[model samples]
Target: MNTAAVVADFRTYPLISALGSVQTLADRVAVEWADGRISPFHHVWLRDNCPCQQCVYSVTREQVFEIVDAPDDLQPTAAHIDAEGCLCLDWHDGHRSRFDPGWLRAHAYDDQSRAERLAGQPQSHLWRSDLQLPVFEYTALMEDPAALLQWLIAVRDIGLTQVRGVPTAPGSLKLIAQRISFIRESNFGVLFNVQSKADADSNAYTAFNLPLHTDLPTRELQPGLQFLHCLVNDAEGGESIFVDGFAIADALRSEDPASFQALCEIPVEFRNKDRHSDYRCLAPIIALDALGRVAEIRMANFLRGAFDTSVEQMPRLYRAYRRFMAMTREPRFRLMQRLNPGELWCFDNRRTLHARNAFDPATGARHFQGCYVDRDELLSRILVLQR
Candidate 1:
């Protein structure tokens, strides 16, 4: 086997440990690494992940072969560690597959290997009022890739970041947002104005006390990163307030387990309707990922619909709902700051709840432009920058 010729996916997997020995089993092959870690690679799993030209498209690097095409009882005829440290296998059906040691070790299903991979994943850093806000300069982020990566990482982990020294011009937010990726346009347009409007379709457009809530809870897929660039903010009493939704959720989980369970299990409807467009979403206010970690916090009191849960569970729902809302209002979790001109806030809309206090429009004018970028684009940009 030629080690140099072994091709994995587009991702480069560094060799962590050398392949020690190979043992063929009835249902799977047991592989022992030089690090003394034994991993079981099932027959179907290995066959499905073949990196050969016939199995995977070279250009796109996507799997072209389907596992269903292989025999249900397919088994490896011979398995051995080649001289080049590659796992060479011969199938009973005349199909051959070669696995690279680096890639194999990286994808090993052993307990220790799985745990290592999980620990390598990026983790969220929860914060409260005392958080030392992650602030970046607009010139640095716009000019240097390193600076942009740092700011994006802060948004990913801390869920809140502020950028100063931005251009105090209308539509300037688009240029900064495009640095991440294309803007996620909504019914409110690509860059929506955040000034008070008389005939405002949503409460966000009016000078009202908007509660701490995630944006666009009515959408099936809420926006990931939100950029609110303040062009002018001379109005009085319009202080921007933020609360770490993840922190509040943690407190709820600890102080009130039943409420947390109710909120996590119960599904509620959120809606936003106007004369032109109508959008509604029925989902749990709190969403957990596969690991049961709080993946998303979707809440918009103004846009919430009536509770239609079972009558028996209505009280539980209200108790959980009110407790969560109260936590958002807690001073300990609130971070109140006034954003001035040429400064913008980039935060995780699904993790950090934001609010605005009602301002007297007669005193002065406040104008802001905001846009959204999806989580897919954010992660892609981060990976590209890392590479």
Candidate 2:
């Protein structure tokens, strides 16, 4: 066959033959054997993108991760090829990982095929109040346990619930948290003996006056639900206030649509710092789930920090934040309650926003033990209950 004909045939039937020994697996992609034979053995495993800590380490300050020290051209070593054709890599910091050949090839092909699904799925209901706070008719929840369950369901749905009959005592809140599985550990445990003084001191662990907000926004993975069982009720001005952020957000969307758009689009910075560590996160103030349903409302002035944005963006963000704060403070948007002991009030941290009025420092002491369970866990339990 002439050169042109041979070349044409090779192009049409491109095949690898055992007759030619394999050299370096060139760039570590798939390898084909004779005539339409493909081997799963090809892989470019340990690319520099692995997230293990050895590949990245903090500098002397321990606050920032440095890929390498200065004065050294410590470029990350290329991934090593193993006998099995897996890509093996040991990062400069001594973290190691192996990439599966087949998985690498599969991932390469998958990039175009798989798009991010979305943040959430379709739900039966979206929780909201006319203003910011859910309107709870005491008659609805106080009358009976079954009615209370309905309110609990609402709280479960919206991420906030109200209780009417909690007796005043430190243990009262604990009892309420116990009625349902009070989520324990991490930023949430049974928080009790928490004094108003803690708030005065600005201590997050044991504080009062938890401003109009959601809890734990600075966490990369935030806890889902917060249950605060109010054990004491004698204090004046210390009414339990609840706000439906979703409701307020929806209203904003309907009213001054520009303001609502600004709130939804801009990123708000939340930060928490103490002597030991500091955490900061930048997230949109109005968070929505898949299907465009309102999910969580996160607006905490105390937790917010200075952000990196243009001067023009700042005014709109500041305006939206102020407007939302104003609506949250509105009495109409608030559902007030004096939770007695035996009432375990749960709120979806992702959806509902909650705040409390300053309690009289002398009206006995206001103590509430609280905990968090993931919203997923709560919903799973609900599903089991439905089943």
Reference-based TM-score of each model: 0.96, 0.57
Clash totals in order: 0, 14
TM-score of 2: 0.57
Put down candidate 2 lDDT per residue, 134-243, tens digits, no spaces: 33434444455565456556667555655655555555555544444565565333564445654332443332556777877777656677867655545666666677
**Best by the lDDT measure:** 1
Cand. 1 Cα-lDDT: 0.92
Candidate 1: which pairs clash? none
Each model's Cα RMSD: 1.7, 14.3
lDDT by residue (77-107, candidate 1, tens digit) is: 9999887889999999999999999888888
